[model samples]
Target: MTSSELWSRATAERYDAEESENSSAAAVEPALAFLAELAGDGRALEFAIGTGRVGVPLRARGVPVVGIELSEHMAAVLRRKADEETLPVVLGDMATTVVPGTFTLVYLVYNTIANLLTQDEQVQCFRNAARHLAPGGRFVVELGVPPLRVLPPGQVAVPFYVSDHHLGFDTFDLVEQTLVSHHFTRDGEDGRYRRGSCRQRYAWPAELDLMARIAGLELEERVADWHRSPFTGESTQHVSVWRGPSPARP
Candidate 1:
């Protein structure tokens, strides 16, 4: 299936319930604190604002929140959670969508950047974030580190999660720098599993730093997780913040 089709109506309907851990307080608190601190009293823009999962809570915290989503069905899911007046959404691709007003904070969370499957498109996404930010505005990203470690010597696929209700794993194309995530969920009493899959053009942390620099942003902080922990070799995911230049700088 294509990348755009990944967020189909059926998927949108089940997203929150199936990935409840992402919406949990424990998973979301660190991100909330960091973004809110950067935004202060200014507005924040969320790319791929699926179901308003993080946006809704951030808005409730008093930071004005707006969204750009490529899938109408996904936005429809978010609409059910919030009204247009409270949390307005624009139906367009985050990479190219131009919403009204500049933002103090523009963010893409939950590894949403991986949805753009090409390197050029990924660079465009960074440019897009810079375009929307006001001077000194910040762009935050939360993503998993590429799982090359799992694929030792000749291995191609490795399991990341195994459980009763869900089974998650990834297959890598080392030469192409791409990976496909395959997920299976057992939601019925009959014990049959439903499968969903998506592809991502993975990038290294240093490569992302270069992309940010190319897009007129500078790396401000790199944390191992949402809790602002120090990054290390063993960390699986990262929450990175990049900033546009200050008024006098560039």
Candidate 2:
């Protein structure tokens, strides 16, 4: 509902290059396979489909995929890869956008739900997904577990990635369930780092399940990753599926 979090054109231009590793075949294939299986001869919808990293390939795998994107800059980058006919992308917020069609599968990946920045907006996202689902269809989400356990005492930030050119860390506001991810990337050989930050609201698995319930959905399956790994206490992320109610017989 808020454009305050919309990604900037500069960020969109560099998004693919900066996230090259994640868009690689190895990193994306497992998720594609998992989603393809769930799609099962029905169409799929992607929330926050930035640059078509997953949607483009999923469509290539023979599944029809539509996207809802909040950032025009991001959608423009996606347009460069696939035309509107091949992969239709509606420019709007994922929390309330309606694309005028039902889907057998609706999915949000890479901790995108946290981008909503508020519990109410996130819950509305679940409701929106439910609204687009055909009877018995599923909504899937891939999110990271909050890293609070790593904060021993008064520590506020948790470093996720550190390298010669890029440094990534997250600072948490536990009281508000919000965190700001800070990224510093070195450009060329300049030895200077470009700093960028994104604010997001973190949620627990149980809280997400409750959101699904509020949207008239039921938890179906949950795993640590697309590979079906068991979600143990030590897991850093999760892939969860919630199914919509089936239609009643006449």
Candidate 3:
């Protein structure tokens, strides 16, 4: 059985089929507004910009945006949406890929950072984000908080979502701070389930902040979502911003 993954051709082909936040203009508009405000006449860079779902819409808002993608298959899918004149994307990994020039804002959204699968690699991702940022520029990340609290004693798995078309859950290795998302979707005409998995290393909010600190970034703001709602204990995910040092101080 074939399953979709970050670097898989099948995943690239069906990446946008789901009704995710990227699928709706209502959800994307607020994110565009937030990013455009931070961009402020400077360019923005997106890490792991799979299929231009956000980049195309962000560019439509008049913000100049470039992207770096690890998978050429996924980048190819993005090319169908917009040409280089509208959105230029480079083929490279977010943890180490470098594009010439700095950006006023660099963002990794939709839990993409979790794809790194290790703490050291995740820190490298933060450093890379800082490397792309101009003085006083900000790095924004949309990530889910680990679902550890929901786990009862001796339970290593948690169901994150269930719907008529899909059932999604996560299995964790707490000691290693690692997790894998298991997704079963009924895309077949016969209604048979197709399984796909993505493994990631989950980090706490504070741990991510520390990674930012190591990368010479400071925590600026953290919200529940793109709406800028205050993050609370009940919030499962966060949209966080970390600012690089101002030029005068650097």
Candidate 4:
């Protein structure tokens, strides 16, 4: 399916409540704190800010947060959490969306960059971020390393989780890096289920650095986690910092 169709279906489905709770904004407090420090009293933009998972809490900390999301359904979920006037969310694709005003920081986290499969689209995303950034602004990206090369054939990895009535299902995909998870609950007489799925491409840290260079940005820092730990070969995830060219210098 096309990316648009995939996203539409994924967002329309009712995601497992337990999964959402477990992966709540509070869970990524460390990352949020790093972002807050990076912004340093400047406005921030979150790409693909689904359900306001990061934006909501970032705003609560008195940081002006704006979001660009492609899925209207997910955006609706975010809106329900906060007043429209308080958090401004633009419904559009992160790869090509154009929003008014410049921001000191722009971030796309949790492997969201891999959602754009092609190299062209990924480079476009960086350019888009550069376009909206103020002088010397930063674009932060967080993603996991690809495990395809190491995983044994026919072996699947944990992709998603859902729980209902203390019973849950975690879907795994061996052939494709995708997942379709369902969680059902029985309430005495009747039972209901919530289902959702997501498919993403994995990326390497080095490749992303080249993409950033092509977008007229420079990699300033690479850390293994939110605490700024030095990145190592064993690290499975990364938080990369890219700096846009200053308007005065360029």
Pick by lDDT: which candidate is best? 2
Q: Which ten residues in a row have the lowest lDDT in candidate 1?
A: 1-10
> Scored by CA lDDT, what does every candidate get?
0.89, 0.95, 0.89, 0.76
- Of the two candidates 3 and 4, the one with more favorable lDDT, higher being better, is 3
Q: Is candidate 2 or candidate 4 better by TM-score?
A: 2
Q: Give the TM-score comparing model 1 with the true structure, all chains together.
A: 0.96
| Candidate 1 deviation (Cα RMSD) | 1.8
Per-residue lDDT of 108-208 in model 3, one digit per residue for the tens? 89898888877778899999999999999999999999989989999999998899888999999988888889999997689899998888888889999
For TM-score, candidate 1 versus 2, the one ahead is 2
lDDT of 4: 0.76
Residue 70, candidate 3: alpha-carbon lDDT: 86
Off by over 4 Å in 3: 1-6, 19-21
Model 2 compared with the native: what TM-score? 0.98
Report the C-alpha displacement of residue 160, candidate 2, in angstroms. Answer: 0.4
lDDT of 1 by residue, 1-250 (tens): 2244347899889999987987898888778888999998899999989899899999989999999998888899999888999999998877777899999999999888888887887888899999999999999999899878767798999898999999999999989888889999997799999998988888888988999999999999999987889999999999899999988843
Clashing residue pairs in candidate 3 are none
Better by lDDT, candidate 4 or 2 = 2
Model 2: per-residue Cα lDDT over 59-123, one tens digit each? 99999999999999999999999999999999999989999889999999999999998899999
Segments of candidate 2 deviating more than 4 angstroms: none
Q: Candidate 1: lDDT over CA atoms?
A: 0.89
- Model 1: per-residue Cα lDDT at residue 98: 84
